[model samples]
Target chain A: MNGKYRFLLAALPLAVVIGLSGFFYDRLGKDPGELPSVLIGKPVPEFTLPGLEDGAPGLASADLRSGTVTIVNVFASWCAPCRIEHPMLTALAKVPKIRLVGIAYKDKIEATRAFLGELGNPYALIGADVTGRVAIDWGVYGVPETYLVSPGGEIVWKHVGPLDETVIRGELLPRAEKLLK
Target chain B: MKFLLRLSSPRRRPGPFAGRVPLSARDPGLRRDDARGWRALALATVLFLSAVPALAIGVDEPMADPAMEAKARDIARGLRCLVCQNQSIEDSNAPLAADLRHIVRERLAAGEDEAAIQKYLVDRYGEWVLMRPPFEPATYALWFGPAALLLTGVGVILWRRRHPATVPEAEALTAEERARLDRLLKDEDPA
Candidate 1:
């Protein structure tokens, strides 16, 4: 009985050390900022908001469900990172069969128009989310977040922060290509 | 000069040491200086105390109904500010947090119940937007992991204490082994 207890006591410390190491090992090399979205693989949240341009038709959830892969970019003119990713988005717009939709998060119509005017408009349809309620539905924590929706309008992938050439070439293009297939 | 000398001197005043001399008996100039210092401190303290309430009340203006305002505050306290991440919407000064607070107030005024308000936010921002995570299957380990570890540790300690180690018994020596031991003892004890 004592031998059994001794074995258990000896094993406990080793077990704890191994367990802690295993827990931390799983977290190693993982990006802390990359929080897995619960909305992934789910249909885009239903919302309808005015267009950035005056007199243009408002965007709706139905607009995204057009039976083609869509890239929804959430950006604000106030966000510095959005400006940084503008050129990349402009380049991505040139890709065939991939519809690029822009959601103007918490930005004014005038500012958004000026932003698009200065940077050159790359978005096919620009939705103005003036109150940011639509942004919350989309689970947007920060501006300059991008999401790739499959033809069925399910959010397949979401990338937070500004897009760069490496990310564009490496992650965005490849995921869009796979979805297109 | 005599008053200045007394003021500058380290001479202990003779008495059952009153913690201080009467201001009137001391140098008038020094007394006036002390009064000015105290006034400045009091003014600063009043300004500081007044400023605190101003800042707190400035962000969250009271609603038309006090009950609705209180309910709004309660809901706002539970919502996390995505911009500041760590701070709750009620506590954060971020523009987003302020907007969320405004929404909460508007919802409360619009006759939405607490649960409905919370659900509205959760639907928009996911479960992470709540400062206190709800009790659900996904959060069971997060809520109970520490307690489980503590119980395991206690059980191990208690079991160990109940079964103390005992020294093992010596084996019975064979006749040849006993003879060898006797021979070694004799060799060591030789005069």
Candidate 2:
């Protein structure tokens, strides 16, 4: 072998090893349940969902575009994690200039109402997703997905699973506050 | 297509434990590890199903038009079942998969072409919905990385062949080696 470039040839195996190790190490820490959404920087999908009940005002894409940062939560009475994340959402609702919206996905209206009633409704507006078509438009795979839509209707941030204090304090609040600025 | 073959990508699932607790309600010890068991079971089932054809779950009502229904199936085969991960919507028994299947049928019934139907899904779920991703800047590596690696390997092999490594010249035998060689030659059995 040529002496000059021999080190490069010798380092090739080590480079491959390091590269593969780094790749697997990154994979090891990642939660397999977290699906990377491509919609993060895009505008919220256009949707018009009926109110949880007939009389109550329904949620529209326009509502999100009403010059306010809307925190859209996809929840369902059937999903258990929604209960776990309900309190953080309530806290978020108290923050001024943020509209906390809820979409009840694939749940009966009565059940949804009863669940919200028990949890103490933190949502400014609740939309019924009886057929789950609206949830589909939102690219909601399952319940308890939260999205932070800017006043301009862009999805600023999203959390797939239930929200905890760590997520609210660390991720959602900071992102929403930035959008506010 | 090769990356698509690697099953299991995350999309965030409900704590399958929290949702189903019929056994755990009565048997306390059974609750904790049940989710893992179910996940393994589901994975096995999905692998088993994928080994066979993309079987219709029989839950979906087919479109009336045979031509349209065939088109729906063709499109559905390319669309992924989110919950089932690698399994196509046609193969998955999940409710959401059924919803997607119906949506495919409905779109076809509405006289939408295959491209339009795919665009609708892509708009909602992004390019991930397609089993075969579209060629774009972001996916250029995925589409051509293997070929690039193979070409580099071939180039290296050809270069090495042309620029063959210099092997050391054979050393001159010392007096001891020469004497030993002569003795060995003399001791050789003559036929």
Candidate 2 per-residue C-alpha lDDT over A18-118 given as tens digits, one digit per residue, 9 for 90 to 100? 99999999899567856777788898888888997778898888899889999999999889999988888888889998899999899999999999889
Q: State the lDDT of candidate 2 residue by residue for B60-113, as single tens digits.
A: 887877777888899999998888888988888889999999999988888898
**Cα shift from native, residue A105, model 2 (Å):** 0.4
Best by DockQ: 1
Lowest lDDT 10-mer window, candidate 2 chain A?
A: A29-38
| Regions more than 4 Å wrong, model 1 | A1-17, A165-171, B1-41, B149-191
TM-score of model number 1? 0.77
Q: Name the regions of candidate 2 deviating beyond 4 angstroms.
A: A21-28, B1-57, B153-170, B173-191
The A-chain TM-scores of all the candidates are: 0.84, 0.89
Report the CAPRI category for model 2.
acceptable
Model 1: share of real contacts kept: 0.47
Once model 1 is optimally superposed onto the true structure by TM-score, how far is the C-alpha of residue A135 displaced, in angstroms? Answer: 1.3
